[model samples]
Target: MSTLPTGYRTVVVPPERIEELRTVDQLAFAVAPDPEADQLLPFPVPHDRLMAVESPDGTYAAVHGSYDLVMPVPGGQVACAGLTWVGVRPDERRRGLLRAMITTHLERSLERGEPVSALFAAEAPIYGRFGYGSAADQVRLTVPRGAALRPVAGSERLTVRLERVDPGRHAELVEDLYVRAGAGRPGWVPRATPALRAYTVGDPPGRRAGCEPLLLATVLDGQDVRGVALFARKASWGEDGADAVVKVREASALDPASTHRLWSFLLDLDLTTTVETPPLAVDDPLLHLLVDPRPTRRRLTDNLWVRLLDVPTALAARRYAGPADVVLEVTDVLLPANAGRWRLVVDADGAADLSRTDVDADVALDVRELGALYLGGRSAAAMGSAGLARGDRAALDRLTTAFASSLAPVCPFMF
Candidate 1:
């Protein structure tokens, strides 16, 4: 573990010190406090998982927290420490307080039997130095209102209803549809706790900047709910006419017809000129449903940054894609136990077994690259071509085939 500077120490943040922790993050992130929002939105992080660095004056200098999450992988799920709310006050910058806090977080997470850690990086470059790899990408689209969609078999029969979002009435419906929508996709993390669930549906007044109150759009077939979308419209007007924009917070659908029905309603809202989609997988169904996608504006961003704290356990947790017998020489600066040659053998059924090996490594790479490939979204051959991974050409091909996922990895919502 990295040592803290003299007279500085790591401490667990209790409920009473939650305000101090929030203050430190608000200062570091340069955001003003909104007490009204605080009352409406439940604090999502568990108090027991919050940690901070205390300076000599008995005040918090840096704060970080983790959520106990079950993250979906290629063929299964694993216990993941979703690292979040990390911040260090500007006055304490460059003092190694962040490093100390990270070490503490890693040790504590590992002790709790979590083999993986994932995060949505606020700043892209900072987490890479700490061994987190950019594992997935999400795209946001500004689709023109009234865009044409290719017809789905039953899309015409499904109906959409829009109403003010209610945690009491729509929380379970939203959560259930979200899980069903991303059934087989990697990195689809669900709201595992009540606090997280509440936060997802919470609509604090302070968060609405001139937009209408948050609304829920549900697609129904008879008595069954097939899809749900959380969104709001910001009113606007120009010389030409009403130029309102529909901003969707999140959307999920169970089937192709539901997806088509849901998006059709969102894209044709009254008085809206365009509809902004939430973070979507690169290969989202809506993209395929569109008759012409060239007119849509898109913004791509890194989605999940993954770090493997225990190499063998993490590797064994997720199934491989194809048959393979390859040895990887992994290097991890933060977790010394993970640095060594490990053999991964996958059977025809995609089950993998990773064990220590004395054999020559077929591929040699740092832990970051391995974590990036862990979800089966990244290609080993591409990494090798970029000189980020080193191995024979054929070995890289086999590794790529073994780790490939049918669907691109994505976490639709920020943690």
Candidate 2:
């Protein structure tokens, strides 16, 4: 366990101390606090899961929290501690506060029976040293309005409804469709609590930043909700006239027809010249449906950074893609129990069995790379080429084939 400096201690952040936590967070992130916005956007962290470093003067020097998340994995889901809201006051840098806080987080998460932890990194370079790996990537697109899509047979038959978002009425609907739409895809994390669900649909005027109130677009087939999109438009006028932009906050569709119908409505919004999408999986259906993708501007980014708190449990939680018998020599710096040889044997049924072993390792990698390969989105051979992993050519090929996923893993929204 990491130790705090003299005169500093870690403390559990209670309800009354939330303001202090927020103050430290705002200072660290360089964002001004809006009380009204806070009232609308529910506090997402549970009190018991919130923690902070207290200075000698009783002020919070740093703060962090986690969400009890059921993170989807290949063929299953695992109890994941979604690490979030991490911040350290600028004046407190290099004091080992962040390291101490992370140690506490890992220990507490493991104590609570969460074998895995995931986060969307504020900065990409900070987490790998702590054993978190860049596990998945998401893509965003800025497409011209009226962009064409190849038609699906039933897309024209489904109808769309657009209205101002109502958290009371639409939160459940949005959550339901989100869960169903991402049924088999790895890294699809749903809003698991009432507060999280409320935050998803919440809109405060102060947070709108000149855009219209958030809106919901639903695609329905005979009163059955087939898809949903949460979006907002910012009006603009230029020499060309009425060149507005549509920004989609989150979108999910259960079927190809629903996806086609939803995008058809979003792309043709009156006065909007372009539409922006939220983060999407690399293999998202919308990408394949676009008739001409060349004209769209695309940005790819790292999505989820995964860490294994309990190596054996985490590896066993997800099913393998193919038959395999291999031993991995994994090194974990933060958690010493994970630093050893682990033999993983997968049968034809894709069920994996992992046990401690002293046999020769077929592959050697750090726990960070293991986390990267955990979701089946990354290739062991590719990491080997990058020198992040080591193995012979055949062993790397066997590991890659056993871990490949047909669909790219992505968590569409940041925690």
Give the true-structure RMSD of model 2: 0.7
- Deviating ranges (above 4 Å) for candidate 1: none
Predicted candidate 1 versus true structure: per-residue lDDT over 12-116, tens digit per residue: 999999999999999999999999989877899999999999999999999999999999999999999999999999999999998898899889999999999
Number of the top-ranking candidate, with lDDT as the measure: 2
Question: What TM-score would each prediction reach against the true structure?
Answer: 0.99, 0.99
How many clashing pairs in candidate 2? 0
Total backbone collisions for each predicted model: 0, 0
